[model samples]
Target: MGIDDRAPGRPRSREADAAILDAALELLIERGAVATSIEQVARRAGVTRATVYRRFPDKAQLLIATIEAAYGDPPPTQEIRDVEHLLTGWASILASPRLRRLLRRLYGAIEDFPEIARAYQRMLGQQRDQARRNVFERARDRGQFPPDTDSDVLLDLLTGAGWQHLAIQPDNCTVEDTERFLRAVLHQAGYRPDGYRQQLVPQGQQPARPGDKE
Candidate 1:
């Protein structure tokens, strides 16, 4: 039978599901994963505990669903105009206190819950791959990067190691550091600075010779 036929009493409401996820996110941000209880979410959402349990089996499932809702779906199409745009997006995500706290909790919880952690990791991998493909496609369309560039390698260099370090590091690293690293890597990979001229060279003129005075 169809979903509606199976539950003839009343179909599950999407609105209530969204409210539960919203409540879960707020509680998670305020009290963290360990302290946030299912009852607290139900109370916050003004729904019964039965409704919450009906949507999510347990706290872990709820947490996972909440995270997915917060991020929304991965972009259907990949596109990266430049390093600046990429860095800007990265900075925005990292700078958000709510997102940071949620990520930190996810990282810690992964150790205790391997299955959930693996699921998250799989989701992340898909996002990274999609992002990598988008970057190459955009760059090629703009003629800014060589068509032959290996997008996968570029993504690994830009995100793989550095992301792990940022996520696991004890001391917090500023977004500036990440931006600087990205710029250097892009320059090394043949990206030219668009707005700024190289220092030690005069604008609209070539560098002065050692024997010739300026």
Candidate 2:
């Protein structure tokens, strides 16, 4: 779809385009940038060299597009209405091992490969950092964090916990344990899910899950 207008007989093939991107991403994760070549990608994708050339002028453009597609733009930041919503948002990340692996691979390799590193940060890293900042700021405004709380520092601490889980604690901790550890961190930061969610419900309506209990 990103290619220039095609000649009369050959309309661009979306399937080939996707196959090339998928193969490129797999190679990027498996072998790193140096080993990911246009010929190899085209072979793995089951496409001719011309198909790849039509979509991307060179290996650099192809690989950059692959990295961008892999690390998608972050979701739009939402208002953090309460501690419970924020906790649930984070709990989902802790629950995903695949996400943990992808993150660890990126985190582990960035320093040695400067071009891919810069491209990744430009594509997804800044957006993710801003999303964290937004959560912390909204939480602070709602009294989940103290007025003096440094959202940036808090973000680092939270991200640090994730990094620890990815690199150091992957074998040592279960997902439940990770959630408990994060909850403890939030508790220290003045976030109490029971306190926030219960207040949001009407007097007669009970909290849907047992997690509402302190």
Candidate 3:
């Protein structure tokens, strides 16, 4: 009936767990969180509702697990050095159809399910914190950022605002545009600018002539 009510002695199957999480993501994308029921997820996974319950205490828990699965574990390595790599990684994530759909669903569901919204907000905070630490550590190693730079503040200025804008803004900002804005902000904040100029130029836009420095 619930996560706490699982039978004693038997270990849960990792394969089954993966299958359920996969199904949950599919349903979340297809139907949005408001329409994605646990029963539907169970059917999609070819498992009983009881099994789904065994793994997750509630819909909120199921959603959390599904989100994590979609996002994957945080990068174990250091932060990206070049702005190109950083922007590329974010572009890849935002360009995913499934992730876009999930985000849309999450935005809609937040109104009706405040608790679920709060849980997701907390998860996003954790993700941002980890990312900031990794990025700052790499920046320090590369001598791009001062050793004493406040990673939390830098992350807030560069990333946290972008995330909030994506979640709240009515218009869909392109990944290139977002990255350009971040690059400018970071550059002004004293972070080294690598590959930022190339990234900011829009495709097919003619470069300024030799005397255009004015």
Point to the candidate with the largest TM-score: 2
* Clashing pairs for predicted structure model 1, backbone only: 78-134
Lowest-scoring 10 consecutive residues by lDDT in candidate 3?
192-201
**How do the residues 1-214 of candidate 1 rate in per-residue lDDT, one tens digit apiece?**
2121234378787778888999999987777777788999988887888788888888877887898788774453435566568766665556455677777666666675565666655646576667666765566555445546677777777665445645764335567765665666666655543422325765787533223464
Pairwise TM-score winner, candidates 1 and 3: 3
Q: What is the lDDT of residue 208 in candidate 1?
A: 38
Judging by lDDT, tell me the better candidate of 2 and 3: 3
**Model 1: residues with Cα > 4 Å off, grouped in runs:** 1-8, 34-37, 58-60, 72-84, 133-157, 160-214
Overall lDDT per candidate, in order of appearance: 0.66, 0.67, 0.69
Question: What TM-score fits each model?
Answer: 0.58, 0.67, 0.61
Q: For candidate 3, lDDT tens digit of each residue in 1-214? A: 2332346777887767988999999988888887889999988887789889888989998998898789885543435655456656665565455676677777778786677778866756566557656776577556566556777787667665556645664445576765666666667666663311223466887543222373
Error of 1 at 157 (Å): 4.6
